[model samples]
Target chain A: MKYILSFVLNGQPVDVLAEPTDTLLDVLREKLRVMSPKRGCDEGDCGACTVLLNGEPVRSCLTLALSVAGQEVMTVEGLSKNGKLHPLQRAFHEHYAAQCGFCTPGMILAAKALLDKNPHPTREEIVEAISGNLCRCGTYQEVLEAVQAVARGEYAEVKE
Target chain B: MGECIYFAPTEIGEAVRLLAEYREKVTVVAGGTDLLPKINYYQLKPEVLLHIGRLGLDYIKEADGKLVIGAATPTSKLASNPLVAERASALAEAARQSGSAAIRTTATIGGNLANASPAADLATPLLILDAELLLTSTRGNRKVAINDFFVGPGKTVLEPDELLIEVSLPHQKGKSVFLKLGRRKAMTLSVVNVAVRLEMEGAQCKDARIALGAMAPVPLRCTRAESLIKGQVLDKSLIDRCAAEAVAESSPIDDQRATSWYRKKAGTVLVARALARAADMEG
Candidate 1:
């Protein structure tokens, strides 16, 4: 029972054939070939598959693909516009936040979701926002620094 | 596992009709926080995945002197809702600490209650608050007290054709608090969680309700412990005795998170702490 699942991916609309059991992570990485969101854990424990569903951070691995029909999903691939990185992405690259790069995509998107809602989040809020995403390389410190730098207006050039 | 039909009905009547038609074969998915993981692991392969997310059940309102929460309402919304925080502080705290921010965004109270985990974070607070669950089917509707909802671990009284539509909490006059003991701060299941509500008249306790989670096959109300505090002043010694008495009603078991012996010890302390916090006697 494959259905045509139509949803807004990033800023564009997309329709893909998906099964009832297919997860959002599966459709994004496999069907659409959007490789930003990682597949570290098929379960929801590891937040490697974190993405923005309607501007809120959610575990795509645990999200049913059919459930997200007609909703908006944003990933790390959609952050950059005209080859210019989003503020969070640029800050992560500059602050050495990507150790293994496995959790970077989810981490950055989670931060973006936070900053979008709360443009200025405190250190604790920043930590709590990305608490679900686990960085196996232990780059939490650097990730924290990167998110803090953005919060402190260090990367004020690129608003998007 | 091969072929499946997914139905995302927009209306509640339509959803219940589908559930009645599919019966045991339909798996109702509200948040998909718990069900998808089981589906991914092949632990549950439903022939019909009935998504109730779009059933217009994500809401919170007050009616008939009760706080009515829609079954599909997410935990994050509950945690931040001003009415919930003011009226049911224990439930708000429990919702705030249920899971990580991401999990809370999608996880629903109905799904958590339906899943019927022994350590369900929402269960303790709801139990202490004397909440009632409204279960609906194509035939009719019935309201069950929260205390009578759970049967055992991963089991509830919900029939295959019935759907939990809403949870209604009557206005209670008490200061309540919730405390959870987990392996870690976030994204961890509770080893033991306690919720205490105390209706205090100056120094003497007017009424008390104590609920403990992960200390039994289901979330349990410590009737003996609660009765001990009624019409009595809650002092240090009395609180300790009540805590011990509450733990006596539990039949915890050794699992990956904790041992039965350890749960009794830690649950006693946790209950005492929650009682103190609820009574505003914390030192």
Candidate 2:
């Protein structure tokens, strides 16, 4: 069945027709062409499809499009404002967090959700936050450092 | 192309009616974490997708000295809830380790129970807590004990017309702990999981409920072990005996994740650790 889903995407109002079986990841990548959220695993195992639904990080690949109606959906593309990257994005670049850049968007968004909720999260908490995301490069230590840097507010003005 | 129909019911009554009407053709979805994955894997192909997310069922409330968790309440909520942490520490711990943060944010407790994975993390804690599950349909509402909720893997006693409404756990004075032996620390399926709740009378074990997961077709309670520790002091001998008894209760299979021997060994270790932690909390 066709359902009209109206949601705020990256600070912009969006109304799209989505099938019930179509995942939010499919709608984002196929319909809207917001291709930042990649289709890596297509399953929830790889955090490649991670996006913020109502300001909380969730695997978009497993999220049905109809379930997100009326909620605020934030993609990695929405993380920046006025051509400025989010602090976590800058931290990733400064700390060389991304290797092939495939898992970058999801990792950054997951960190964004964590830092927003807990600005001073511990190392264990940082690891727990990105535990769902899998970086095949196995750069967990560098990724952890980058997230910790942003949480400490050390890179707050890096994008500016 | 034929498309499946979708129904989003804002009210519980409407949801119940929709389920009744759709019957076998419908599947209820809350967070869509488990259901969507199954659907994508072609394990489930329902003609109608009934979305219950709009029913405002995502809540954890304490009423009448019971912690009532709505079926739609996310794992992330349960993991962070102070009441769950204090009253049902095992449940909170299980929720914390269920999946990744993103998966937990989307995975609902009801989905976990309904999925009926023998290794389901929440099942062990709920079993130890003696939690009651409420199932609602257009006919009426009925409550079933968590132990009786599952029949086998990926199966439950839920009727086609019934929807799981909430899970109510009694507020008890005791110490509880949950331990999971997964392949890795995070995002790994359990090889063996254990939950132990100890009611202590000044260091003497008054009562114990030990639940083991992934070691059988359904998450099971080691009643023999529970009986062994009743009215006895929780010392090394008792812990060892109970651990051995817990291992005896398991009928683990040789699956890809683990072997039967390894599962039995891990079950013994988890039971001991869970009991020890519960005893420590009592002390």
Candidate 3:
């Protein structure tokens, strides 16, 4: 049942052996040892397992590994460059957005997906964009503020 | 874990052939938003998972006076496509309201219909649009009306060898609106959803279609309500009567989402609001 999956992980091409039933989240976290994407409510209801598939946010839990065989995938670990934290990551830290830090990766990545398309999103747009991501710690306002800060050019520089 | 075989076909012809060969042993997964969840829950256990993602079926085009949406077209496309928004606003609204941004990005229209959930949000809007599904097999392709596609809850008339290819509907001349009442604002299934499309000529209603979801075993078009409102002038009393007819047509059941009685009453209110919205009237 194992198949060789050739996909672009972050910016590099990766060939990982995975089973047909294995999800992208499973392969990313277990095989590749990329632990940013967490499995929460593996049914796709909770956005804890969200990752960008070809620049669009999707439920990695519901996505079969075979489906992403020839696609590009980006996890929270890939958000930064040259070992520096991405703007969203810096904003999250500065604004105290990661209350429990469980949903932070998914939330920040979801915001990245939104900001990539609409860099100047309004408050309402930001809320709608992150509606899929659930924050059990009730840090929605903080997350919103962090994303808004980045959109406002406050967190434009990469952090050390 | 080792029991299932995943087949990702690069060609549509091969996909059809594979389906014909496997029959009941295979299950087609387009977006996997619904199917994978069901599979994870052990609710469905098909031996083979046929992935039709690369079949070149994802498209939204208009030709020959009809808007044709390829089966693999994701809900996000439906929500953003200007053609769909202008020609079929109800469908656009329904697609936007169906799931969260992540779910909408991946879930395809084909998967939404083929899954045949009674609470399917797209069903009501598609019903109001009088959508026709293009079901394909190795034998050939056939276009079936949306009304005849559903059998019951989580069931459809799709054969094991058939794959839904396209959804086609004419450009209707009217105002249409879709509304759903759910427990939460987002990421929740509808308790009772209603879609209404009405053609108005001055003060008289020329034609109308009333479609309700999660109110029956399958999403149902309220023919009685349609008949009642069609050719009738806009009025509060007539709208109330039409709403009552809509309630009478559906057969809701008690579930975690809502009670049968709540669905009946709330369905009536939503239907009346949709109808009034279609007529550009206040309810």
Candidate 4:
């Protein structure tokens, strides 16, 4: 019932032993201790478990750990390099996108995936990209602004 | 609960063999968007999880004038595919309105069909397109019309040993439209959905297909409404009558999301809007 899964996590290669019943969110948060991806709703309703699978945003809570073998999986913890935050992270801070901060990591990662594919997404595009993420704090207006700011390259060099 | 085994087969033959070997003990996972939820809700428990994501079953192809979509093809792919947009506009529209971007990126067309939810957004469009489902097992492969695929709510004619392979949509020259009435703009289940495909011959309706969802036990085509519209001039009176017929044909139920009475009224509105769009009539 155990399988060896080798995948590229963030920017590093990782090989982990996984059970078939283990979800990606569980492995990421419990086994790997990469807790950026939260387990808000284990049933994929909350976007608190969003992560990038092959540069596309997906609900890690719904993804099976075995299904991610040989695929590139990126978590919110992988968004920074050399202690520097990603542009979207900085934009969130600058634009006050986070209120409760529980949905922040997932929102930022989802926006990162969108910006990676579309560097200059319009306001409507930004709205569509983050539609999966739910910010119960009702910070949607600010989240939209933060993502738009990053898309406009306004927060490209902001410090963490 | 006992430990479950996972199998990722790269080839269709291997997948078929695994399904045959496991039978009722195995569940095929494509996107996991639906399956994982069911598992989390304790609605289903399988001893084996067979992943078909790596089986090269995620491509959209055109073969012999039919649009052949592999079962594992994600809703996001269908929503953004240019071929789907051009040939099967209604399907593309359904894909676009299915769920949020993240859900769409992982939700497969096969899962949507296999789930057999009456509110499934893609079902009505596929029905309008005259789609056929290709199912394979170790025994053999068989194709069934989309209309015949569903037996009831959350149920399909698919056997436990069979895995859905592909969905083939006939190529038709016409304009098609899909309209869904949900609770909210995004990530909301359909209260009522309608798909209309109209083949026009200089303003007169040459042929028409109308399919309604979330208003019956299974997504169904409004045959009487289609018959009334076919060969008739596209007009307000005709559209109203057809919408009424469509509403009359549905057997909606009262659920937490909506009431049967509300669904019938909304069904009429969706049908009218879809017919108007098919007729090139704008507000």
- Say which candidate scores most in lDDT: 1
DockQ values of all predictions: 0.83, 0.79, 0.79, 0.81
Candidate 1 residues B1-283, lDDT tens each? 7889999999989998999899999999999998988999999888999999998899999999999999999999999999999889999999988888889989999999999998999999999999999999998999999999999988999999999999999999999999999987677889999999999987789999999999999999999999999999889899999999999989999998899999999999999999898888999
Which window of 10 residues has the lowest lDDT sum in candidate 4 chain B? B37-46
User: How large is the i-RMS for each model, in angstroms?
Assistant: 0.8, 1.1, 1.1, 1.1
Q: Give the 10-residue window scoring lowest on summed lDDT in candidate 2 chain B.
A: B274-283
User: Which lDDT tens digits does candidate 4 get at residues A1-160?
Assistant: 7888889999899988888878898789888899989889888888999999999989998998889988999987888788897788888998889998999888988888888888988888888888889999988999999888777778776553
How do the candidates rank by TM-score, highest first?
A: 1, 3, 4, 2
Over 4 Å off in model 4, which ranges? A157-160
Place model 2 in a CAPRI quality band. medium
* Leading candidate by DockQ: 1
Tens digits of per-residue lDDT for model 3 on B1-283?
A: 5478889998989999999999999989999999887776778776888999999999999989999999999999999999999999999999989889999988999999999999899999999899999999999999899999999998999998999999998889899999989888888899999999999997699999999999999999999889987888988889989999999998999998789989999998998898888998883
Q: Model 2: residues >4 Å from true position, as ranges?
A: A158-160, B281-283
| TM (B chain), model 2 | 0.97
Q: Which prediction has more favorable DockQ, 2 or 4?
A: 4
Q: In candidate 1 chain B, where is summed lDDT lowest over 10 consecutive residues? A: B181-190
Best-to-worst ranking by lDDT: 1, 3, 4, 2
Name model 1 segments beyond 4 Å from true. none
- Candidate 1 at residue B248, lDDT? 97
Candidate 1 chain A: 10-residue stretch with minimal lDDT: A151-160
